[model samples]
Target: MPLAVWFVAVVAVSFALAYLNSSGWFWIGAGAVVLLAGLGSGAFPMDLFLVLSAIFALCSVVLGVSPLRRLLVSRSLLAWYRGQLPAMSQTEQEAIDAGTVWWDGDLFSGRPDWGKLLAVPRPKLTPEEQSFLDGETEQLCAMVNDWETTQVYQDLPPHAWQFIKDKGFLGMIIPKKYGGKEFSATLHSQVIQKLGTRCSAATVHVMVPNSLGPAELLLHYGTEEQKNYYLPRLAKGLEIPCFGLTNPHAGSDAAAIPDFGIVCKGMWEGREVLGMRVTWEKRYITLGPISTLLGLAFRLHDPDHLLGSREDIGITCALVRTDTPGVNIGRRHNPLNAVFQNGPNWGKDVFMPLDWIIGGPKMAGQGWRMLMECLAAGRSISLPSSGTGYAKLAARATGAYARVRSQFKTPIGKFEGIEEA
Candidate 1:
């Protein structure tokens, strides 16, 4: 072959080997061997081959060295491309810190631990949970269908709401000691899946409290007094809870929230106490309009360094009654024609005792981490269960329709395309 053809062949072969094996050292070695063969055959000048060999030898040395190899692999072209984007938000960073990468070893490492994956126990429902799911959940579905067709109210009717509360659907994840059903995660997902298939509105209503409510936050981080006061009310449906995390400007970037609370002395219930004056403008808060209790996230400011030496104590989570003096709620947003109560809520100079912070005063600056941990669990369980419910509904409806509707004097489902679908 001509020298130019041989050069092209060598370059192609070197690249192919490197791409296949993910090793640049292989590319250098292959290129050197091809160049040496060409020089031996007098297909290339000795001086040119000598210069090429020197360059290839240097590249091989760099690729072979541990430190240089690590630098090259870590600062990859993909990494450089991703670096142009914004940094991970506080919520994302906290999620990483919260140990979100539980099963990702299978993705990075060539060998996967099949035994560990197989060892995870499948969740089973208790007898009481099974009864509630078979009986009360089915009854609730009928009621939801009636309400949806009648269009009697935009939100769930008062009777339906009361029935859900009475059945303990809102507190599925709360402990039995706290007056809740305390269903297992698997049972909770099952209930949500059933509810989602019937009424997405009702599913959202039930999921908020079960997944990311004051009950969850309080259970994990609330003080003894806080848990005692709130958990039962939450379990019994005496109080409706809404989480206020998304701000008008912040959206998913919870760390960028501009809502703030400044530490100060305040008057509460005709007595003086140490507290924070909170001002927040939040939107897209689920159940905001009808919620009786608010789980608020804000940037805490301690100018006097009362909480710590730092001026900003990062994000903090607190509970504020919807009926609190400065709170402004009741506005609702219509999302996708769904009757779920989601909307904007704001407060001006809302003041509460320092103990109102979830997990008490000691957890004042630890809200971001708390939210991240709760969200990691919530995101994995709730949304996927709901999505599975939707897929189930679609499959059943499509299968029924395909069987009943005929084409070419035969059922459409008999066709290969429809059967595959």
Candidate 2:
């Protein structure tokens, strides 16, 4: 039925019910009818108005409140109804467009010639970055050809890894003093998107180091020595770093205690170094099973307040080597999502000096904040880039296949469905 007919029938029945003094039951059914008609109409939020009407009817029944009286009260349902009536008001005019044939509803303007739809302008690339992107594309094409033949996708090919490293791709966002490319955030996104079109695995591996590694933390709070040491290596890909944030006890809880054991009672003599045995069960780490360097976050149990006077405080970030004593590297698990490589990374009572702290010793209890900042920037690029690139590639592949493969005595591309009409 037409929306106007339904709405008229509803209002007529509601008036009859109100005249017969059966406002209670009548309002309920009338509100429901209005809500359904409004939704089907898709002209505005009619459901909200219906809900308010129902609330007013209920208030009148329970509190002996008249509809007019309810309207006078602050935050009354009737007030809500009056406020929303403007949203439903519409002027009679034809909202026409060049390619449109008819009005379907307010949801969308129909266009018979969809090809003529205006597209947003693509971003113009900078000169140096454009040159780099062209070079990378050629390099990646070569790599993909070799990868297809070799059945060896366990790790990046040496030449591919070398190419990325030589171009300072890993250090694009890292501080320039640390031998980084120091490219803008937009450039980083573009490069990652380009890589995603070719292979997702390589893109993620490159992203993890560039975005989530110790460089982000160092740039935020690392000591001069720590920044000097790690940033240069990270840019050169000499040190592959992974974030160790999620734990078995704290899957999504940022405030959970990680349970680091205290082996010795008294504080260490003649030094600010405090010793503890950290026992943790971590999982879902990007490079946990294979990282050479780890940016680990664990809870500290400072009894005597040696490390800036706190006990059972929140988590802290540490730059620990994977090869350190008592650290356990679990076997890599097949994630079923062919791209991101992740596995269990557990540790047993790992002891380290105070210098192991990211930013030397001052960056305690600030790991979660740092992790959020880095991961936020990382996600903005990684997922979107991969999805867009894959979609574009799939579209290209489908178009080519449709052109070559034929049906109905002609190439499928020649058909109305396949061809741009």
Candidate 3:
């Protein structure tokens, strides 16, 4: 990383290229002159020689940046690098053929497409970390290609869901002790990118658990005992989780409401209990209809009254069993362009022991902050993956179609007007 070492590496590469071409000898000679002059100047100066070397190195970098940016947008450049494409071995091809539809044909072929132009690279992971991504990619391909249209909503095959759980992907960012991969933010980004290319629904499903779920909240504030209890279940997929933040009537304004859910202190069945009874309607709750565990948020009531004082009526989040006494999950709703069964969850007088509150009693009145923390790292990730994948789809389909679909006695891709646009 030092300047001298960097300069040597750059000059060596340049000389190697020069040796390949007979005319490159002249440029090599010029470089040698610059090096000798720089060395001679070094003896007579304080910092002048080092400063000139730095300027030349920086100028070389700036000169390279533009060509690299253009190469990313060039179809011809990708074609030139066709030899670098990892060949689909017979076993890999058979794996695709035996898998689902998304992995078939050009879908998983890593075909060059124009959509790469729109994608902003998030970050790169180490080669070792990126090696884990192919499994995620193949699994995602099967999920996307295998969506079956049922009498009701479209269903992701059970095998696909199981594949996700088995890959150590269900809890990507959870602690290693909890059965998660515990990868860095960069690794998570790569996994998301690979999954994104195959299916948006699968990407969402994979990310929600890793991003805004109890895994993160537990990591942030749960006691060691609490983590030991829940993190493993979540990581293993024994307990499917859903967040309960947005309420139907309240929508995004739930924090401003009163008398949303009731809380009281008492003994339940001889156990000292701080319990809550929630009565609210929440909709568009991702994974809500199918989740086994629900992470609920509500405004608390006073011990003496249903609607407590503002200070006493604090906002709280709880980890509740979706199968708890008064809870009801509705049919799947399809509001988005692509849908995988999401809908409303209603709780009428649902009660749970106070320990169900995340972080126990110590985290009281911090529901909003906790929710924000849960959502912070996940906001740009999920949507960008979806958008990038869709962009790639558009680009690949469009470019290939243009090449093959002809008009006016030529391929559409060759039309001057189209190219002008």
Candidate 4:
């Protein structure tokens, strides 16, 4: 390029670069100029030197006797950005807050600390886990008959379901003190991966209790009284547990749930007690039809302001017995005849004690946070492991079918279309 044209282009680039607000250019330019002046001399024009110095100064402003040069973001532009964002709910906020800030910091910086990562020890399963995987896991897979589970029973066979409970499959995430295996997250994931391969129905059966049911909630947020009473029973499979979060209107958006509970006093066992009158309709709840205990999430209201001045306390989760008065259970929704105990459950004016709340009365409106923190584990482990198992099954089936499936005296595997796959 021509000298005059090149100089103008460089000047323009330097002017544009000023908005970036970096100070490194000052040190780099100064070092280069000092080194050049110290080296063997060649005739250099004063005009060129002056122009270069000007360009270097323009490269950065903060280093030029100015304490700060950070360009303040435009208020109008920021307002437009804020307007572009959708209204976030309490559940959404908790979801965002669930992951550690440092987790993203290293990743977003494009230079994750490999030394720190490597310094972290690898997770390994105990002897018990390996033994269980080799024994009960294989036994369960042997009993799985997809045709019978999906069509005839529309669920896992009675014995197979019982075997899952007997093996403590539902209690992997629970602590040892709660009569559970207290397996590490890695072991839990591996268990899901193994179970996912042979039977999706069994996988769902085991995963539901391990992932999102009352057991998990109780472990995380339940009061001491609640934990002592519920955790062991859940771990031992004495009580089948299912969480009711998806209302008909809410679907996957837990925040939009229209199901509600009103704080009031109700007659319980011949005594007037502080409690809530909850009404809810939840669909597609895994193990719902057969669950003994229901963990229900509902918007709580204090119309009488019994707890405080605020009328609307916010979303709260409460444990309700499936056999409670006005409780509706044991209904099935045939979801493509999938072999899992998935169905809808509802209740109208069902009364539960204030103590039934997951974290008791004080945790009212904190259900979303509890759910979010617990859900991160489920989302990471259960979903990915389930998908991995399904993909393996699909690939094996496709490969097997291609060998025999033929047209024009040539196997489908020989065809270009099939070959590409």
The estimated TM-scores of all candidates read 0.83, 0.64, 0.65, 0.82
Off by over 4 Å in 1: 2-7, 10-18, 21-32, 40-43, 67-95, 105-121, 126-128, 146-150, 398-421
User: For model 1, what is the C-alpha lDDT against the true structure?
Assistant: 0.84
Summarize candidate 1's per-residue lDDT along 1-421 as a digit string, tens digits: 4698787878788678856775756666677778878888778788988888888777777777878866876569568879888987655676568645645668576667788788988777889889988999998987885256337677787788889999998888888898999888888888889987777788888888888768888988899999888999999999999999999788957688999999989788899999999999989889899899999999899998877787888799999999988899956888776788899899988888998999988898788888877885578788888888878878887899999999999999999988787
Position 45, candidate 4: lDDT? 59
Give the residue spans of candidate 2 off by over 4 A. 1-126, 145-150, 248-253, 256-272, 337-340, 407-421
lDDT of 4 by residue, 1-421 (tens): 3455544654665565565554666555644554345232433455665676666566545344333433333455578899999999666777677646644478887768878777878888789888988888889999986666776777788898789889888888889898998987888888888878888898888878888778888888899999989999998899999999998888957678999999999999999999999999999999899899999999999999889998887888889889998989856877776768888889888888899999899999888777877776779888788778878888988999999998999999999988999
Indicate the residue-level lDDT of 158 in model 3.
73
If the candidates were sorted by their lDDT against the true structure, best first, what order would they fall in? 1, 4, 3, 2
Query: Which candidate gets the maximum TM-score versus the true structure?
Result: 1
For each candidate, the alpha-carbon lDDT, in order, equals 0.84, 0.68, 0.69, 0.81
Off by over 4 Å in 4: 1-59, 62-66, 70-96, 99-120
Worst 10 residues of 2 by lDDT: 89-98
Q: Pick the candidate with the highest lDDT.
A: 1
